[model samples]
Target: MNINIKFPDNSVHQFPRNTTPLQIAENISSGLARDVITASVNGKLVDVNYPIQEDARIELFKFDSLPGKEIYWHSTAHLMAQAVKDLFPEVQVTIGPAIENGFYYDFDKDVPFTDEDLEKIETRMKELARENLEYKRREVSREEAIEIFRKMKENYKIEILEEIPPGEKISIYSQGNFTDLCRGPHIIHTGKIKAIKLLKISGAYWRGDARNKMLQRIYGISFPTSKELNQYLVDLEEAKKRDHRKIGKDLDLYSISDDIGAGLVLWHPNGAMIRNVVERYWIDKHLEADYKIVYTPHIGKSELWDTSGHLGFYRESMYSPMLVDEQEYYVKPMNCPFHIAIYQSQKRSYKELPLKYAEMGTVYRYEHSGALHGLMRVRGFTVDDAHIICTPEQLYDEVEKTLVFSLDMLRDFGFRDFKIYLATMPEKAVGERQNWDQATESLREALHKNKIAYEMDEGGGAFYGPKIDIKVKDSLNRLWQCSTIQFDFNLPQRFNMEYIAPDNQPHRPFMVHRALLGSVERFFGTLIEYHSGNFPLWLCPIQVQILPISENYEDYARSVYAEIRQHGIRAEIDLKSEKIGYKIREAEVRKIPYMFIVGQKEKEEGTVSVRRHTAGDLGSFLLQDIVKRLKEEILTKK
Candidate 1:
């Protein structure tokens, strides 16, 4: 019998039952077969050699796609592992996995890998790749797999095997006398990987538990061609120059202290000013959109969390509860439950069905110290959170509005490229199946109606419900998840939240947890890198710098600064008695958008010489005229 295979273009063809993707690709065309990196059947990723035994929807990927890149990176990781084993016979590989940028492999070796070692390993990997070694998979019983690892003295592999449930099919892949346990549909041959680079080495606790032995993890990147690899290396260097931690310190924007704790951030004055501007703009926009801005306490009764299911599902990330008045209290990890409590404070009706509550609430979470980085990953941060409680009839409209608002908000910040995802219900989810299906369909329809393209994340939704996640692309073309519009089928039912409907019967209201700019701290860090510290006029903390040609023009500079301040420009005057050139350089270093230079010629004329950051000096203009231009630019958000 033949199986009906549906291609991505919605075209279907009959194929032999045991025919593989490789065979199908060859039958279609030799060019497609050569270009195809991998294929997915019914949303499940599989290698080109995977047999198509049943009717399925097939998607073929090339090197450019995300899934294809991940598969390629993972295969390179195995090649690197093979190279290490050949170079250092004593080194024992534990686990290697592909990440966002590249791949890393952990090894239980006594000596840490050095720079010289990385170079040697990379050279060996390239040599092996050119050998065209074929990858062969062998399935074995769990007991037999454990025995194989035991004979090889691979303790980590044995530990992994012991944890697997009984009767689960186990397999090992081998290429050129090197074998390791894996659940793989790897590329057919090593020759497919064209370029490889071993980046660096770091220590990682086995299984992420500090108590376990520290293993040396080697990170690397690979590409199908040498040119792409070279481009990625160039971008990698540029990323280092724009590192947020270095920029933060240079501009005195923020700091993370060991004394205060790892993941908590201290926002310096400059950073706070930026945050204040963002918050004010956020409030004004929400108010214009008819969102009621409200405040909630940082801590809530433990019973509230228990009712919201946070205690059960999200306890690992939440802080330990403290006893207050003989009852437990938890620092809120979220603000939605508190918003629900406020709704419960008064009886609501169908007329008030679509209630939008917005807040700039700070919440605490527990992140491993090792994972903490500058601003991006923090324990304590404010969330630009909002929730919309609406009736079933209004669900799709509300979702669409939230999506549009999110796009507008991001656009105002100069983000142009967006990648949207519609995540459906996971296997382990709460709420009725019918409700989940309806909510997922509503989000899908909203995306379609708005003409927004999105990918379906088959099971990427929270356990509570489905969601729409929007990721903004930065200057380096890196995607950052900033906006989320999630349905909450669990909360309304858990809290018995309802609004009286037109039929005079109480009905559970649909709740959408919407966050644009996800976390203030993370978004701020992203902005620092996105703008390269040269923020737009409206968001710049110090919009203008007043520089005097000499001490003789100090008074003139002060007057210019004062006049600009009166016009609501964020201005600073150079009072260090430094040369005008030095002051201008200092202003440029700080990335101020504009600079006003004063001299005797300009002071006598009541005019100031202007300079734009990263640009040369402009001709002199009357101070009032310049102020008007600045105000207009700021008002227009240029």
Candidate 2:
């Protein structure tokens, strides 16, 4: 029998019924066969060695592609697990999975892994890789799989096996003497991983449950070539230098205190200034764009959350409710419910079909102590939210407008490169099929109309509806998720939202929950790292520093500062007894956008010598001329 294989470009070719992906690649071209890492058979990821049994859509992946990299990293994770188990006889492995940039394996060990232990384990990995052991897979009945794990004393694997859906095939992979229970499509051989680097070690709770025993997690990355690994290491170093935690502390921007508890940020004066500037501009632009600004309270009754279905589905992430007037009140994990409450407070008509309610609301969620990062992952942070209530007839236009506005906002903040994703409805989802189709189509058409390229995330949407996710690429070439325009059919239905139509009939309002620079703290952190702490002129907390060459020019500096201040520049004057070079150096250290050096020559000439950050010694310019230029840059966000 013959089977038809469809390529990603919609071309089909005939092959034997049991021909493997590798064989098909070989039949096509030798070069393709050499580079092919794995193939997606009928939308399911499968090994290159797996036989093609029928007509299917096949997309072959190489090492550089995202899917291929994930598979490659996952294979390396299994290799690492093997090495660790070989070195530590008593240690039991839980799970090892691939993550962004690398892979991590959790081990049920008595103590945490040390540097010396990592060195020995990594050495063993290299030896095993050199042996070129082919990873062989075998299918077994569920009971037999359980028996295998039980004999190996891998209790974690057995627990994972118990959770596997009934009728799903249970498979085990073995390379050398180590075997693991995984529904895998791993690399052909250990030799494929040519370069390896064990990044770090950390403790993770088993299955991410705090009540479970903490396990030692070893994080690492591998590459097909040594050059790629070296470059990644260099990028890692650069990332450390640009780390927001270090930059925030050095600049005295913000602090997360042990006293105030983890995950709550204390924004210092500098950080607060940055936030104020962003909020002011945000409000101004929102008003210009016709978004109605609204304020919602920090806490809401448990009944409110219950009605919103959050207490049922999202209780784990939410903090315990406090007693308020004999009722349970929760620190809101989101602002959508309150926005819905506002809409419910009054009856509406089609004339108010597209009402956009915007808010800069602070909400709190319970993040485990281990999960809290500097500002990126926090318990409490302000979100720039906008909920649009519109009729089905207006959904398409509203989504398009929101997309344009979101893109514009991100660009204004100096983000040029973007990674967009159009995520469609998931398997277990709410809403009618017609509504889901229309909502997904609206998002798709908006991207197409804007000529924006985006990847399709199949079945990756929220249970409520489809969404468009925007991730901005930072200077380090790392993608950070920022803007989102998510449709919510579930919320409107749960809240019984309604707006009268022209025919005098009540209809469910289509709800869109959107945000740009989603979290203020996270966005601020990204901004800090994006510019490497040297913020752009408009966004910089301290825009200008008036450094006098000496106390003789202090009066001149003060005058320059006042003029700049009048022009609405964030200016400051240095009056400390320091050398001219020292003051200039200090100004640079502060990452001030501009430094006006006033001396006798410049003071008499009615000018200040300019020293711009990133470009040293911009020469002399008239105070009025410089001020005009500064204002333009700030206004234009240059």
Indicate which candidate wins on lDDT.
2
lDDT of 1: 0.89
lDDT of 2 at 322: 95
Question: What value of lDDT does candidate 2 attain over all alpha carbons?
Answer: 0.90
lDDT by residue (tens digit), candidate 1, 218-302 = 9999998999999999988887778778899999999998999889999999999999999999999999998999999999998
Shift in Å, residue 454, candidate 2: 4.3
Q: Write the per-residue lDDT of candidate 2 for residues 444-511, one digit (tens) a residue.
A: 99899999999998987877789999986554556667888999888999999999998999999999
CA lDDT, every model vs. true structure:
0.89, 0.90
User: In model 1, what are the clashing residue pairs, if there are any?
Assistant: none
**In terms of TM-score, how similar is model 1 to the real structure?**
0.78
Model 1 residue runs over 4 Å out of place are: 1-79, 89-116, 126-196, 202-217, 222-231, 426-429, 473-480
How many pairs of residues in model 2 come into backbone collision?
A: 0
Task: Give the Å shift of residue 96 in candidate 1.
Answer: 6.8
TM-score per model over all chains: 0.78, 0.78
lDDT of 2 at 542: 88
